[model samples]
Target: MTVTDDPVRQQASREATRWLILLQEESDDPEISAEFDAWLAAASVNREAWAQTEKAMGLVARLSPGNTSSWCDSTGGGVDMLRQPRRRIPKRAAWTGSVVALAACVALFFTAPSLLLRLRADAMTGTAETRVLHMADGSEVTLAPGSAVSINNKDGRRSVTLLAGEALFSVVHDPAHPFVVKTGNFTTTDIGTVFDVRRTESGVDVAVRSGRVQVSGGSILAQGRELGAGGGLTASVAGFHADERSAEQVGVWADGLLVANDEPLGQVVARLKPYLSGMVIVPSHLSSQRVSGVYSLTDPGRALEAVVQARQGSVHRYSRWLTILR
Candidate 1:
């Protein structure tokens, strides 16, 4: 059949044939298996799409070199009666169009990884805590816990939206693709440097470390800037001026390290939540007790011991859970 002869039908046939070839070539791949399973699970339309392609291939396979030569030239399927040639289709091109379809499938299979990587590059992070991801494009992002961000690359622009929690990002030298981070009411963009951000009770907190970041009017600044090496900027929900401090104390959780530099006992307990399964309680009054030391995140026990000794506070341990206070 020519391109114009039932073009829609032919296109569907080609697509279905392509997928069949893809399935055969990637039969061993778990994803392909899953996709096929899903396809098979779907309604009859999918099956129809497959059947049409198979039919097209069947027609091609039935043609011989002489017929194929004529078929190619005629721009149509021509049946010459008197000069009939033996219908021995070329092994390479004929039959169910399987060979051609399969070749296309094989080519696509090799390229699938790269395509998937591009999709994945859009956005992903882990639980219990967020992460700082450095994309291939050099854009940096601080992923919040239980949050997924998708980066859409279109028309020389990169855009990201936080599906959950919050993220603070500092975009690096990508003038071609302006970086945009969107979270509910707040939207922030980077000029090219360092900045910290997190979702708060009201809205979101945005603080620039090196480069500047623009926080929309809807932004909810951090309660207080947790300052140090890489501290946060805490601003009141209503107030504009931010209390800037080293964000290292809270930021260290990414490495599973909870560093408290003259931090209150209560705040330290809050930092430990991401690493430990259960809660660590520091009574309201004890929360004010200052703590200064380096704790081995891998072994919270060791850090607890040092803190207790240094502050003359007591330590209570209960099945992987601990409480420390003066």
Candidate 2:
């Protein structure tokens, strides 16, 4: 049997396909591009695996012009077709091949590190899946969908690195072992608190549910702000925003609902993208409009429709995976 027939190889190819799709969707982000380069440099296996997957996808594109569903399936059946030895192709059939070639080019040009980070994370949550993890030190962490974190505890120091998405942390008080969460350039150290940390494309956001926490790094206003209960801080490349909300209201995404208070449509779309399976594109004109609502994360499509409808905009869905808000 060829490599594609092997279960391990097939799984890798499936995962690689997902990464390829995501990278293409977010090609405009420079941070993602840099992270992708780092991921490619981190391991030889990653490059090899991606190359093989790309080759197989190319073969599929050449053989089957427009119907990607046949070869994009994750059941290894698509790879099986590519692996067959006797498939013949005519020299000149006026093949429609530009879209497939463009997809491959985009995938190669915009590989993301999120997939690699998820593979290496100690714990992760899949699309629309939440997980509550109990740490060895009696601490608890609730991971939002599409989130990943790696834990390390040694010599009375406990820490976790938030690789992607969001997480609500309930850190146990242990003066001897301070609990810290690292996301991007920012580091949040818990002062006996329950807090939420979300890593966005540009920066990090910290919301304290109870107790207090210290946030440092990344153009933070006033040098490592200490936020108590019901306080929050958002540190981004543009600047920072310090706000206040109820302790119970923090990390509301964990409850299957997203609460947005006068947030822009673009930001709301960005927040909802991780929960949905595929691409949700909002036009630049509609993205700047303000939106405020308690939308259900469980039904992202319906929630998006509601948000757009309020502004007299409409949502056009080409497929279950592709939705365009205009």
Candidate 3:
């Protein structure tokens, strides 16, 4: 059953997933396997939870390594980790080099867009991190946290592909070579303008801060649409949506400010996540909640409280590295 179907089973599933992760990480140590067996023998529900958790974690194996039914024979399905060998985790230790960073199943949230971005992005930023890159075509790109991009300035070709997250571009107005930014299905070409392109869960958002831009895509773009300053367009494969937004409101995140205007709470948390030195967990239910606010990107904890509390939710910081919104 899903988490919504049974809360008791949900707790078991969560614990099982945690045990699986720990065993995979410390498989060489026998103590972990013994502890896991003890937990499993303590209750029959634990075995069911383990099986369900393993099935769920199977997806992680596709994205990452060392995830398999053979992670151990702890479940009598693979090599016995207790007999073969897992470590004593120090209290309050860092969760470094674990699946906690880019988990695939927990709450069904993926921090980064895709594993491909990790290998392909010429420039990328980690949690709550931002990067500024000067392209070979005299253009500048500001990448938001949890963002990645591949720059193609070779042979004097001014092209950039935003692999993930959001970016603000400042073009040098090189008519000889039109600066282009591509993300998903949308291609935004600078017509002597500065603009912002953000990749969201639904579509790609292109907004001009100054000058104009010619956006061309599939038939959805209506034959190469053009947007001027204060104009914004959100284009997806199915269609596009156009809106008017002030330049100051377009890419204010570059200045450590986030002005959410009826945006989803999930998107806001995704934006601020890069700034905080931790993870923010927003269940799928609360993710759809609409929110509007002006918060400091520099102070994500306070901002997170403001955003979650406004929606009648509470922020619980389990540690410096993890926060859950409920």
Give the better candidate number (1 or 2) by TM-score: 2
lDDT by residue for model 2 over 1-326, one digit each (tens)?
Answer: 02223466555455566555545444455786676667657666656666755664454212233223232332522232223357643222112133344444345333455568757799988767899999998899999988999988877779999998999999898877789999988899999999999998788999999999999886555378899999988898678889997788898888888887888998888888777765778888899999888898888767777788878888754333456677
Query: Once model 2 is optimally superposed onto the true structure by TM-score, how far is the C-alpha of residue 98 displaced, in angstroms?
Result: 7.0
Regions of candidate 3 where Cα sits further than 4 Å from its true position: 1-115, 276-279, 283-285, 319-322
State each candidate's clash count: 23, 0, 11
Best candidate according to TM-score = 2
Worst 10 residues of 3 by lDDT: 61-70
> Which candidate has the highest lDDT of all?
3
Arrange candidates by TM-score, descending: 2, 3, 1
**Per-residue error (Å), model 1, residue 325:** 6.6
